[model samples]
Target: MSSPGPRSSVSPSGRSWRDRRLDRDGSLGLRLTLAAVAAFLVLVPFALLAVLVVGSWTPLHELDAAVTAALHRFAADHPGWVRVMKAWTHVFSPGPLRVAALAVVVWVWRRGSRRLALWVVTTMAVGGALGALLKLLVGRDRPELLDPVARAAGFSFPSGHALNATLAAGVLLLVFLPFARGRPGGRLLLWTVAVLLVGVTGLSRVALGVHWASDVLGGWLLGGAVVAATAAAFRTWREQAGLPAGRTTVDGVAPELVDPHA
Candidate 1:
């Protein structure tokens, strides 16, 4: 019998095209990619609002007014839910966030990743400052068609709670994702919680009748910008310090499993 034909080599770890691309590029590349997307989200939405939506846009303004008024009235009509929402909303406010920030910083430091801890703190600080500055520039009035159910003082173009919550949650998740590398469904769960936190916090402002819907949307976009920039910076700094760039492998997948070439 003729000898068996040569058998093709199998990777032993069934990798895919995406895996190979990620492995070749690694962590810094991934961060930079995300940063590009985030920058687009940040600039585009804000510019659209500043140039088109804020003025010379009667229909959009009407929509914002309708939604804001509806939510405010709905919450007021439901006394029980209003109370719960108010309490839940505070968790994202400055008072509660101060404690949460302290806890996260301490935990990261104790875990021996001072760079990550510092990244969290600084990202939040800078994002908050930017939010404040943007609010000043927009100088949009709060929705006063309904009585405000919560105390607030500021120009309302962008909701500070929404912006701050997005930044804080995004930074925390990105920084700690490496730890979830091997845990099943860990990244999904983290993302779910983060998105929920951001969504609810933004809605809470509308629920209280203190912010228009557009304000929350702007905050969300702005927060995305901050998260992307800080994440990119964090990884970049590691490379500068001579630390090996983290592999692009996520959720503990071995490079070979995802990289077809491997």
Candidate 2:
């Protein structure tokens, strides 16, 4: 019998080169599909809102005006509610949220999760910068109320308070979720808190008469998009490093964080 030609290279796991290539291509395709889906879910809404805001769509403008007027009227009648919203907005403002994120970055870095720390910083910075840039580009005015419950300066197409709150909630949730992995109740609580924070922050902006309904909605969409995009990028990095794909929804951005020695 003729001697066999050079044999195909096989990994220790017994996967041939062609099998490995196919696996890699499939993984990459999955990642791309995920990214596309995320973009569609978040960016599409944000872009549509931006277009409507820019074009001064009559129905949207009418809806914003009606919502603002109704909220302002309610604030006028309920001093206690106004005070509570003011307190909530102040506590969750961008400044305090950024400070909290910085503290987490320090904690994670000290724990030897240097990359995770970097991700926290990058996500916050990018979100903040994008918010500011969009504010300038859109140059939309804040809702003007005869008796404003709260006041904010600068352009207001997207509510900064809502954007920052969403970012902070998402970052904190992902960073701490590894610790809650095995506890269903803990996971449920975390999700509830995150949703509550994002929802109330946006509502406070509209109720306080500093932002239109659309503005707050825009902030939420943009903020969520930022978080999803950065998290996806991080996931891609983990895969390229030969790590198992993380169930980000359940385990957070880096389940490796649960390892005391990781």
Query: What do the candidate models score in CA lDDT, each in turn?
Result: 0.71, 0.89
Where in model 2 is the C-alpha error above 4 Å?
1-23, 26-33
User: TM-score, each model?
Assistant: 0.75, 0.88
Over 21-138, each residue of candidate 2 has an lDDT whose tens digit, in order, gives: 4454555555655675776787888999999999999999999999999999999999999999999999999999999999999999988889999999999999999999999999
lDDT at residue 232 of model 2 (Cα atoms)? 88
Clashing pairs in 1: 19-258, 181-251, 181-252
lDDT by residue (1-262, candidate 1, tens digit) is: 8999887864725756455434524553454555556567666776787654457488778989899778877887898878877887887885576567768889767766677678778878888889888778777877666356776777987788888888877766665556666675887888788889899988888887878888888888888777767766665566545554555224221112222233
RMSD of each: 10.3, 4.6
In terms of TM-score, the best-performing candidate is 2
TM-score of 1: 0.75
Model 1 score (lDDT): 0.71
